[model samples]
Target: MLTDNQRGGIIAGYYLGHSCRAIAKVVGCHHSSVMSWPPAID
Candidate 1:
């Protein structure tokens, strides 16, 4: 499971126009995990 900080970073990175793969790299997670983030975060 993702930590709250990881999840928040994913959400923030995505909304800041970062790609899922890029966010995943920064978050140290799989790209698919970033892609799987809920749209509600957008």
Candidate 2:
């Protein structure tokens, strides 16, 4: 599983306009995971 820092990295990258696939590649997770971040983060 990815650490919070890793997940935050994915969220930041996505917020920067990076594609879900790109964020997933950098964060080592599936693209679908991108949808579960950002908004779900508290």
Candidate 3:
């Protein structure tokens, strides 16, 4: 289970143009985990 801070960082990193693999590296999670996040609502 990801902490709130980890989830927030993933979301922020994604919006900031970081790739899922890159965000996973920073967040210490699997790339697939990052990719599994819900699509951003515009």
Candidate 4:
């Protein structure tokens, strides 16, 4: 599971034009996880 801070970072990274693979590296998750995360953000 991702922390609130990590989820926030992923969102920020996504909007900033970072790739899912790159964001996943920073957050320590898989690219697929990153790809699946945005829609579920709440």
The lowest-lDDT stretch of 10 consecutive residues in candidate 4 is: 33-42
Q: Deviation in angstroms for 29 in model 3?
A: 30
**Cα lDDT, all candidates:** 0.67, 0.64, 0.64, 0.66
Local error of candidate 2 at residue 29 (angstroms): 31
lDDT of model 3, residue 34: 48
Give one digit per residue, the lDDT tens place, for model 3 in 3-42.
Answer: 9999898778666544665577778886564465545521
Error of 3 at 18 (Å): 6.5
Q: Which stretches of candidate 3 lie over 4 Å from their true place?
A: 18-42
lDDT of 2 by residue, 1-42 (tens): 999999888778667545555567788886564545455443
Candidate 2: worst-modelled 10 consecutive residues by lDDT: 33-42
Worst 10 residues of 3 by lDDT: 33-42
Name model 4 segments beyond 4 Å from true. Answer: 18-42
| Cα-based TM-score, every candidate | 0.40, 0.38, 0.40, 0.39
**Model 4 lDDT vs. the true structure?**
0.66
Give the residue spans of candidate 2 off by over 4 A. 18-42
Model 2, position 27: C-alpha lDDT score: 84
